[model samples]
Target: MVTIKDIAKELNLSYSTVSLALNASPMVSKTTMRRVKEAAREMGYKPNAMARALVLKRSGIIGIIVPDITNPFFSSVAFGAEQAAHKRGYNLLICNTEWNDELESHHLTLIVEKKIDGLLIASVNKKNHLLEGIIKQDLPLVFISSAYPSARCNFVGIDAEPGGYLVGKHLTDLGHREIAFVGGKFNSFSVQRRYAGFIKALADQKIAFNKEYTLSGEFSIESGYENGIKLLKKFPKVTATMAADDLIAVGMLKAMLERGIRVPQDFSIVGFDDIFIASLPGIELTTVFQEKKLMGELAMNILLDELNSGGDSKREKKSIVLSPRLVIRNTTAPPHSE
Candidate 1:
């Protein structure tokens, strides 16, 4: 436990001089500062973060709350956030809320109580009142994927509506009149916006919207597989499918394969969020590529900027909507001619 006192004693300087040097106080002479830094480095001195936080009123820690940790999309976002935080010499505290509002509220309270610098949250529910309460507290927060319609908070996420529209249009353009949508709960804003886009796209193409073709399922592989089987069984004439996310697409692919229904040959499929698994050898899913890494990094950067800018800096509520690109892969193709 090497302390600043040890470095000062070794260099025959006062503790204040060492502290000023470490803090990069402009008052310290450059030559003396250099010597103090060298001494501290030689002694392998490490500052106590808790003590420093108490003195400076900065925890040097940021909290990230996600809906589910098991999902590859969220995991990849976390990876990017961790990398960005590390590069800026800050620590990231990650918590998975498992899409539970109570757990999400609990984690938010704990993180705030711990005095984390800021928060990056992918909320369990867009309507979580706890989030509005946190916003009123003037805590620097940036919503990752989910956002409240009226909350005055910064947000970073993809334009999901357009992404969904593209999926619908692509399938429709392939001469497929009968298509189905799978994944996401109805209450979610993400699901609603995506479904709206799908419907709008269909309307643009003069294709009748069929309520029976839309299926709501949990955002999981198993849910996708189960719902996919039911949808196919119920709509045997369906020629294409659009999934809410990559995991759903993968699950649907699994079900299709198991049922001896060849993809693109019998039923073309498209997915959202081109996750790592989407490009796997057998599952070259044509999907919308949401820049998950960039979104995470941007959210963290916004949080860090807010933390460092102090409380008086005009609270900036920025909304950044990133565009999703369509990644053409092997899964999507024109309907097979007889």
Candidate 2:
């Protein structure tokens, strides 16, 4: 492990000059900085991430907490965040909370102990008061997906309600009257917004919104399958189904297919978050296209901005809500012939 000191010694430069040049401080001339960088590269010198962090109060690491990495949506988010971090010469440490409050709390505590520069959370547990303490301490905290309703912080996500409304409106326009909804936990902020928007859209169209048609499950294909069974049996007259996410939609698709229900002929379906699997030839799920990658990039960039700007008390926080587009595909159609 070659150190900056070795490069300085080899170049016969002062240690302070070398350090300033390596940091790219404006105090050091650009020519000197270039020469120092080149020399460091030639020497294969690696900056001591922890050692330098102690002096500068920057760990060169951003911490990201997510519920599940196995989900394609979250994978895209991680990819975009990783790309942005690399561009800015930083690294990210990702922790999967698996929807456990204790796990999320543990990761938060560890990140704080590490003196990590910033945090990005695709939070599952909204009641985590530790997060409030983190925010109060002025750490750069950015919510990557849905955030708490009242917390004043940087947030990056699609407009959840509007995205749901898009699906509802599309179904309604296609002459779908008796529609059913499948979604994640009702307590989730994202779930609530989506359900609310879906209901509002149906109400605007004067379609009867049946409370019995709304069902909650975990955000997984298995959960979707289970709910599909209940939905079809109890609401046989349903003309279409609106899923809160692509995964749920995909699950429901499987259930319907197994039951010999012809898609778009017997029933139509719509989903949110046009994840990769939604575009598979057999699936082709009509869904709202959220800029998943862009969301991650924006969240990381926002955190970086917060970290670099000193995150002063007076700096106003901002939330970035991207637009969602409806991707019409094979999964949806007008009601079938009676």
User: Which candidate comes out best when scored by lDDT?
Assistant: 2
Candidate 2's residue-wise lDDT over 291-326, tens digit each?
999888999888876666565656778798888799
| Candidate 1 residue spans exceeding 4 A from truth | 1-48
Q: How well is each residue in 1-338 modelled by candidate 1, as lDDT tens digits?
A: 99888888899999888876775555678899789877877888777777767766888788899889899889888888889887555788999999887898889789868878788887557676766777777878888876778867788998788888998899898898888888677787877788789888999999997888889888888888997799778998888989988888888989999999899798898988899989889999999998888888998888776665564336667889998788999998888777
**lDDT values, one for every candidate:** 0.83, 0.85
Regions of model 2 farther than 4 Å from truth? 1-47
Clashing pairs in 1: none
